[model samples]
Target: MSDVKDRVLDAAVDLFARQGYDATSVAQVISRAGVTKGGFYHHYASKEALLYEVYGDLIARQLTALEQILARRLRPADTLRAVIGDLVGSTAASAQRALVFWRELHRLGHERTEEYRRSRRRYHDAVQQLIADGQATGEFTAVASPEVVTFTIFGVINELPLWYRPDGRKQPAELATELADLVLAALEG
Candidate 1:
């Protein structure tokens, strides 16, 4: 993304977080972004486009990361830890965008919502499959179903935005490692 587009997206996230999607206007986004209507339009079709991109961009990046991790062909448990760390770190890095997008997700049109959900499901399936593979190979315990394990991991990550603070004692990477340890222990023990 160019500098202008980055500003527009960031401003939108901040505004949407503070005022909500319904309450925010295109003009306010332009103003907050310090860009002209033409400039904003050059990057985004409308306020709705920005809204979608807030979470859209984040998830897209995550899906790309998932691909790279898969391409490395690591063991299932190693892959799971990498996936966990990637999600935790990325969500924390874009905390405001993640929070705002999820809060305003219901506002998206049915088509866009489905698209987003598809991408999310892809990620979910990968993680669940990783756990299932590990269990099948006797690398991970079968104490819990893959669905349960996958949801358990995502549940913590999805809630991070509610409580994460930049000034917190633990950095995102540290948090990621700790989370990976816990999940791996449950699976590997």
Candidate 2:
């Protein structure tokens, strides 16, 4: 994205998180972005498109990170830790956008919603598969089903925006390490 487009998206996420999607307008986004209507229109077709892009861009970056992590061919425990770290770090960095996206996800149209679901499912499936493989190889204990383990790990990550604060003592990497330790311990037993 161009600087203008990034500005527009950032403004949209901030406004949408604060004022909400239906309450926000294209004019407000453009104004907050410090761009003209023509500039906004040059990038986004409508406010809805900007809303989708807010979450879409985040997920796209995450998927790329997931691919890179997988390519490293780390041990199952190491890979899981890396994945958790990536998720927590990225999500904490963009908590506002994540909050807005999750709260207003239902407002997205069917096609865009499906696309979002597919991206999320891809991440979910990869984690679940990793757990299953670990169990099969005796690298991780089958204390819980892979499905349950996957959901549990993601449940914490997905809800982080609700309680995580950048100003807090715990940084993203610290939290990621703690969370990964907890999950890895469970998997070990």
Candidate 3:
């Protein structure tokens, strides 16, 4: 992406997080990005197109991180712990953009919504495969189907951005470790 496109995405994410999809306008995004309307149009066909670019970037980062962690061949339980720990830190560092991604995906209509779902499924499949690997090796006991377990774990991990506040009192890794324990206890035993 060009610097102009990156600026537009950054500004779009901040505006969407603060003002919401319905409330934000293409003009506002352009102005905030400091790009002319022609430049914005050159990069994106419309507001929806711009949204997809921003969302795709977020989904790519998440999927890449998961792939890197699972590729390490760690124990299933340990891999999950590290994955969730990374998730907590990533969510803390990018809370506004994460929230915007979630909110806009939900706010989008059927066609664009389906695209988001596919991107989501790719990430979910990676985690489910890790769980299946663990189960096959007897590293993890399956109390629930891999799908169910993956979804539940993702639900817990992904919701952190909605409620997490960065205070000097607690660190993201510390909170992630606690969350990891809960996830392991629920799925492993």
Ranking by lDDT: 2, 1, 3
TM-score of each: 0.97, 0.97, 0.85
Clashing pairs in 3: none
Residue 75, model 1, lDDT: 93
Question: Per-residue CA lDDT of candidate 1, range 51-135, in tens?
Answer: 8899899999999999999899999988988998999999999999999988999898888889999999999998888888899
Better of 1 and 2 by TM-score: 2
TM match of model 1 to true structure: 0.97
lDDT string for model 3 (71-159, tens) is 89788898988888777787777777777777777666678778888988887887788788888887778787789888887887678
Instruction: State each model's C-alpha RMSD to the native.
Output: 1.0, 0.9, 2.3
Alpha carbon lDDT of each predicted model:
0.92, 0.93, 0.82
Task: Judging by TM-score against the true structure, name the best candidate.
Answer: 2
Candidate 2 achieves a global lDDT of 0.93
Candidate 2 vs candidate 3, lDDT winner: 2
**Judged by lDDT relative to the true structure, which candidate is superior, 1 or 3?**
1
